[model samples]
Target: MKPKASPKTDQSTVRQRIVDMAARLFHQQGYNQTGINQLIEEAGVAKASLYQHFKTKDDVLQAYLAQVSQDWFRQVERAIAPLDTPKEKVLALFDLLKSFLESVDFRGCNFQNALVELPPAELNTRQLIRGHKTKMSQVITDLLADADPDLAAQISLLFEGALITSQLYHSVEPVNAARRIVERLL
Candidate 1:
């Protein structure tokens, strides 16, 4: 018989399962509303097991944000990688948002959602959220090098506004509007 798998492998699977379950719950519900007890219950892990992996509830939330950020970055980069031009890449960003809105799991932007209840002094999570936005804005900045210096900032606002507006109206109209404006700016 083949050698048995190490216990570490199984433990990692449990950790990943917990993170995955927490991610879904946190998105479907609100971060402020998610509790550690609920996460343990839904994740099907004992309190001791959760503590062994995550020091605290905040740690679990941070871990969820970290994982989602990685996935989101990869998704956007992949979606724009084969585009014909930077303009196409920029527009493709809108397309990405469109798909996100159309998804059955559509929740407001995770980074933005995480910051909702945070006090002004919450720098770690704020920095994490800012980093995601900055990278996204850099894509716009790279694509619009010849435009106004503030164009990226403007587009960034429009980009964020689209997410909030879409959430407000429960429609993708705002993303389309932002795309039109971006097209004009480009």
Candidate 2:
């Protein structure tokens, strides 16, 4: 006889689907605005199932943050892997951001946006944001190990400022502006 299928047969992928939906909704709609009911309805999971996967909305936020950190860094690393110079890697960062600025999903840095939703005393959320920024800084550090410290700092500042300006103006001009700054630094 074949094994019986349960109503919860979708359990295997339910959590991942929930996390993915939450990430998308949180990024596109803003964390403060997305609600638990919507997360379940969109994920196609029952309320019990959502609760089973995540104790609270905050849990899902953490999962989304983790996913963003991992996905963003992995992409940046892969995008620069074929390049041969620190300058190339540094410039490539803007190229990557340019694509993001053009994408329909553009909403600035997720970590930075979350700061508006989460209180400063929210340790886990704050740490995740800090950790993401630190990793980004390390990427620049590794890429510019032999470059001038001032130049590295300037590039980092431009990269960050570009994200905000691009989001605010809904234009790639900020990225272009940052690229120009980077050229002068180099």
Candidate 3:
């Protein structure tokens, strides 16, 4: 017979499930358009359970972004893991980005979509988006140091442009365009 699990493990599992569901819904639909009922239904959790985990939908949205940020960072690290040089690592970033675009459920960058929907009054949501940008920019800055320090800033901007443009246009060409530009510049 198995030992009884701790309450903490159960709570964390539920919290993670909620985040997963919200991330998917928030990506497929805009943040404002996704209702709590949908999240609860998709997550297969009771309304009270969700409320116990988060006081409001805004809180869940923030958690979803935070989860995405962490998962993205891990993916970045994994993408660059096999590459030995910083330049290879820089190129690897584009490859990793391409993989995301090709994913079956790819919508857009959730953080970008959320930022567009989050108004001035949604300070917490805005801060979460800004934080993700800063972190991703820092990753670019580190990877591009071997190519050119200043180029990191440009590359970071280009990365964002690619993400937003590809998302809006529903074309992988924008990402390819950015990658070509990066290759030519570096």
- State candidate 3's TM-score: 0.92
Candidate 3 CA-lDDT value: 0.86
Provide the overall lDDT of each model, using Cα atoms, as 2-decimal numbers.
0.84, 0.87, 0.86
159-181: candidate 3 lDDT, tens digit per residue = 88988788788777888899999
Best-fitting candidate, scored by TM-score: 3
Residue pairs whose backbone atoms clash in candidate 3:
none
Q: What order do you get sorting by lDDT, best first? A: 2, 3, 1
List all candidate RMSDs to the true structure.
1.8, 2.5, 1.6
TM agreement with the true structure for every prediction: 0.91, 0.91, 0.92
Report residue 149 deviation for candidate 3 (angstroms). 3.2
Higher-scoring candidate on lDDT, 1 or 3: 3
**Model 1: per-residue Cα lDDT over 104-175, one tens digit each:** 344778888888867798787788888888888887787778778798789888998998888778889999
Model 2 segments beyond 4 Å from truth? 1-12
Positional deviation of residue 101's Cα in model 3 after best superposition, in angstroms: 1.3
